[model samples]
Target chain A: MSRPVRVSPQELRQTLIEAIVEVAPDVDPTTIDPCEDLAEQLALDSVDMLATLVSVNERTGIEIPERDYPKLATLDDAVAYLVHAAVRQVDAAARQEEDSSI
Target chain B: MPSLGADMESGTLLEWRVKPGDVVKRGDIVAVVDTSKAEIEVEIFQDGTVEQLLVAEGTRVPVGTVLATLQTTSDESERAQAPSAPPPPTEGPSAERPRVSPVARRAAERLGVDITSLHGSGPNGAITLADVQGTAGSTQAARAVKPDEAPAPSVAADRQAAMRQAIGALMARSKKEIPHYYLQSTIDLSGALEWLGKANETRPMSERLLPAALLLSATAKAAKEAPAMNGFWRSDAFQPAEHVHLGVAVSLRGGGLVAPAIRDADRKSVDELMASLNDLVRRARVGVLRSSEMFDPTITVTNLGDLGAEVVHGVIYPPQVALVGFGAVGERPWAHSGMLGVRPLVTVTLAGDHRVSDGAEGSRVLALGGRYRQRPEEREK
Candidate 1:
């Protein structure tokens, strides 16, 4: 899938918060501090954290590999990683489509 | 009808999946029964042909009431006779038992309670599990069967209230009848977490393992080591169980909770336990649990830590002599090898029935659980 319209960093953060809330219904979105460790702040266990990442992937179409999990310690970190990865993914999809057209 | 829980007195038959002349095997979901807690799918224990349906849809029958009559199936069909006018000979060890609930009869047989001398306090003066226990212990066995029982409510608010009452009855009974002795220990989880991280590094989200699985496995393994804390307190004595059927407390999304047993949990590995936990939680919330899962828990383990609780002092479920609880694993001040530092630590607690065991035996359970968690690689079973 191609994302002709780019998603902003703010939107990515919002998506991350929503995903976290979905994984942990007990967690309050308003209480989340973007700079702090999300797992620690929200009491997200390993399974909860993994589920949150999966929910994020489903929403943004950005696959966060297991190796890159450490990069998502905080909300800001996750947003930055997703924003960068989405751009790379969109660029790759665009190039592939252009090649197919040729 | 199966005694789904200690709090259950009667259940309303919702639907019958099997009809007369249909064949059913052991573990087959024969019918759905609605208790105060949830809608449970009742399973038949013996392979037999459905001879007749004794109870109809929407009939609220008390525990031990025969829902249907089954003619035993066998290879020797040549000797098979038509369904006789008289009731077929009762099958299994509970056969020919008069005035005793099936579950209570089984408990009596196990606990060596002389049913002939005791008087039943149940409906029609039938010998119930509490009656059998009363004969064995000095403490009064709580009467679970309510005489003026209300109909199963349909609305969510009413259902929630009903669940609250059910839980309240059980908890009050536990506190009143069982003299509980509690012991707590702080377990270092740095080693376990490190191992889990390395183990999950290459796996996808769906295949990854959770710390709760490890804790449960450890508790099951520990129950095996601490035999005194692994069985029921019945007939004024401790009846040690042969297998570790670990009860897991799963809270529903709507409201309230159910603690169902994972049979032979000690025999399962961490990966298998994780899979079972996932499937169990899914089915439990959806309210389609099996009869055996509801009835056969030898011990219970509650992990309130998953929801961010720092510590738990859980009440022991009746008949089961012990309850194991795990709090959230958090970074805490630790001293290791003469150095003070912060480490991921979990506070594990054991609530033991004083009538059956002492604090030393309870401590052994926590100690063994701590060892297994601190050294996950050594958890062979």
Candidate 2:
């Protein structure tokens, strides 16, 4: 049986920074504070936020719904949200696999 | 038919925003098209009932191809009463007119040059500004002229390459065909920035206005005062746009530029302009621009402030008679009331079509833009 791969917070943070850079190349990802509000610090507008979300989704294969977008206000918050979502997705897949096997 | 841009030879019809039997009015978005740069929303020009969609979605057709049939108010009733009556003659070669860029038409008017007497040197033998300007009193009606031909279908993959090719074609044509004149003005932005600061202080972070919005608003007002710099040069003369739809240039994330029009810039408040500009920039980067926004801009405003440029002398987008460019705004030593003081200043440059308007008119537009900046409150009205 194959086990689901786990995404670490550090890896997620790197992914988030890469995604942000994809949307706004002018932004210096290294200077971004993990806990600071991205909109306030980087002047990331709504469009940039959407682009970042799309890029992260494409990179990580994780879907972040619009309703949950408000929870992802900072780099740290996004990393945490992504980690939790990935865990949930893995759990759902495992449960479905177990039911199918039975 | 709408020419989205000079580089766009053909577009693939993506989807219809309005279905058959739907009533559509002027400026109403009816269809969406996939262009070389982005997917733009296409708007119709007249009030009518959509009789049928002539072209199915996903079909790549050349520019000037009719994608749909609209029955005007009079025609709708006539067709309803006499279903068997032969339809009005289709718009065929007999009704076809010589293809001439709007700028060429306007230039021909100014120079009193007969455009029909000259051979077109532009793509598909379309009359260009240079062709009109080059042919003065020469009875060269027999000049070898090529017939109009459809541009070859572009490969959908490698969007960046297509974009580059499109940009190259347009820029090359602009530089080669248009006789451009440049004008520059140093505007004192202290008053405008002061007002913006106060206004932003009272607004939320997301709603706070950017300096670019103020500059755009001032440009629109300036366009209103200096009408010559505010419209398309077409049909042998300058056709001043009834409304100021300012096209703001935005750089995409994947490396291309698109300028979508902010409709009725003169009528909108600064806050409204800010919201629209933000939305337009976001959509432009995301590649979801509407067709009307792509083709409706009568004038273009490019702000290179964020890039840290001190001045920008931009090339005029074809059909558009003038392009207004703004450079970085910074605190500089200024002489107001004969006293030296630090004030925010920005260098404004206007690249105008010499055939349509001279440097004098371009200077007037820039001066008006500066004057509007001093009275920033008037923009809200």
After TM-score superposition, the amount by which residue B204's alpha carbon in candidate 1 deviates from its true location, in angstroms, is: 1.6
Mind giving the per-residue lDDT tens digits that candidate 2 earns over A25-45? 434465789898886677665
Candidate 2 lDDT over residue span B1-381, tens digit each: 357876789888766677667889988978768787877878887899987666666677778776767889778531222222223223321222344543454456555667676777543466655566557424344541121110111222356688888988888888887788998988888888888878866653456677888888999888877778888877768888899999998866435688889999988888889889877875665456877788778889988765568899998887888899988888889999999999999999999998888988787778888988877986665
Best candidate according to TM-score: 1
Off by over 4 Å in 2: A1-102, B18-28, B76-157, B337-339, B378-381
For candidate 2 chain B, the 10 contiguous residues with the lowest summed lDDT are B144-153
Candidate 1 reference-contact recovery: 0.13
User: TM-scores of all models?
Assistant: 0.71, 0.64
The numbered model that scores best in DockQ is 1
Give per-residue CA lDDT, model 1, range A6-92, as digits (tens): 368988887887666444433446657889988777665555676678667767778667778889999989889989998888888
lDDT of 1 by residue, B4-69 (tens): 988888888766777777788889988878887767888988898887766667678778777777
